[model samples]
Target: MNRRHLLTITAAALAAPRLCFAQDAWPSRPVTLLVPFAAGGSNDVVARFMAPVLEQKFGQSFIIDNRPGGGGSLGMGMVVRARPDAQTLLVSSASNHVFHPLVSGDVGYDVREVLVGVSMLTDVPTVLAANPGIGVNTVPELIAKIRATRGGFAFGSSGAGTSNHLAGELFRMRMDLDMTHVPYRGGGPALTDLVAGTIPIAFMNLPTVAPAAEDGRLKIIGVCTGERVSVRPNLPTVMEQGVPDFAVRSWTGLFAPRGTPQAIVDRLGTAVREALAAPPLVARLTALAAEPIVMTPAQTDAFVRQEYERWGPVVRSANISANG
Candidate 1:
């Protein structure tokens, strides 16, 4: 071969391995899981539990960064603008991925278009809980009590446009009850108020309010799932209790910015699925009233899209917004 051609071939051969290494070295540094809600919420709980497992699997530290504001849109926006290197991922849920975009018109970008789903982590059932002082133990009684009171009553939730808030709105619409939604900064505060009797009723995540219900501080009037959840199979569903066609579950998942390498995404999804399948993680999630849902990356994406479509009409019909 000519010297010039030999030199060019030598250079090309040396450069190929470097490119392969760069592509394979993903998560070469610590990964950041950005949770849009406060630390104590369900999304945070899922992220925190999965971080250690991911760290071990990837051989790098997985850090959770809680950025709470704008009803989770704030943290979502941060992820939308981040590099699609899998170094930073958004720990997303129904609140931001499905409901917020439908309610908040100025989100700047479509969530499904900007974020790619990695895996679905868990599905948490929403519960209709009432303070013990409400003198109601079932959905029928709660509806009767609300009807008897001439003035409308308020029901609290984690925040405006959250899954629980949407569940409350759906119940109000379905039952034709006069109820105003009270949005707290987070589920922890709303739950605290429910236990303290500051709010008579709340539609909250089962995990958040299960402890109080067990202690007799509050009563779970009904589970909001269409069918009973495995964690609390004895609890009746709102639909079974007389509210027709009602189901709302707050789910958590992992999402990378659009354009993230498919390899990195697949690796992450595999790790998450394995973690969810393990006995220890399953036990922990079950105790928290959260069910581990193992979905492939494609399935996760399809599920998010389905949720967005499912809740769009609900938001529009109820006129839900972030400001309220």
Candidate 2:
């Protein structure tokens, strides 16, 4: 071969190794798992639990940063605008990723377009609960009481566009009940009000309200999952209580920017699955009433898309908006 051709070939061969090295050296620094909601929420708790495991697996720190505002749009926008180097990832849930976008006008970035799912961490079933004063022990009783009250009944939820809120809307739509929604800042406030009988009933995360139910402060009418959950197998599902196709779960997942490398995404997904399978992590998640749902990157993407499609009609039919 000609001298120029030989030199060109040699240079190409030399550069290929460097390119692979750079690609393999992902996370090169401490990674940030940005949670769009306030701390102590399900998303934050899951992130904190997985951070150490990810750190050990990657040999890099995985720090969780909470930026709560605009119903999670603020932090979501930040992550959407971040570089797709796997250094800054998003730890989000169905509330922000699916429900909020469906009900809000402009969330700055479309989740489907700007973010890609890496892994689905866990699924927490929602519970339809009532204050003791409501004197309703089951879904049928609650339905009867709602029908009896000519003034109509009101139900509480974590926030206007949250998953629990949508679940309430779904319940209202399915049962053809004349119910109004009472949105609180978060589940904690909503639970406090439910326990105080400020609201007759509320749909909340099972984990958040399990304590109250156990203490007799509140009555869990039924879980919103399609089937009974392992955490509370004795508690029947809304569907079993005569509400057909009534299943709503609050799920947390890991996501990266759209342009993030597939290899890194797959690596992260595998790491998450492994961490979730660990006995200690499984026990902790079970204790919190959260079921670990480990999914591959492709499965996670499909699940998010399915959720987005499933909740869109509910939001539109219920006429739910970000304002209320």
Best by TM-score: 1
Model 2 has an lDDT value of 0.86
Candidate 1: the clashing residue pairs are none
* Candidate 1 structure quality by residue, lDDT tens digits, 1-324: 999999999999999887667668878899999998877778888888999989888899999998877778889899999998988999988887888778887689888788998999999899999999989999999999999987798999888888888899889889899998898766777888999999999998898888788889999999999899988999999999999989988888999999987888988899999999999989988888999999999999999889877888778988876776
- Ten residues in sequence with the least summed lDDT for candidate 1: 18-27
lDDT of 1 at 114: 88
lDDT digits (tens) for residues 166-267 of candidate 2: 888889889999998888755667888899999999998887787788889999999999889988899999999999878888888999999987888888
TM-scores of the models, in the order given: 0.91, 0.84
Position 214, candidate 1: lDDT: 88
Off by over 4 Å in 2: 1-19, 147-152, 195-198
- Clash count, candidate 2: 0
Where model 1 places Cα greater than 4 Å from the true spot, the runs are: 1-16
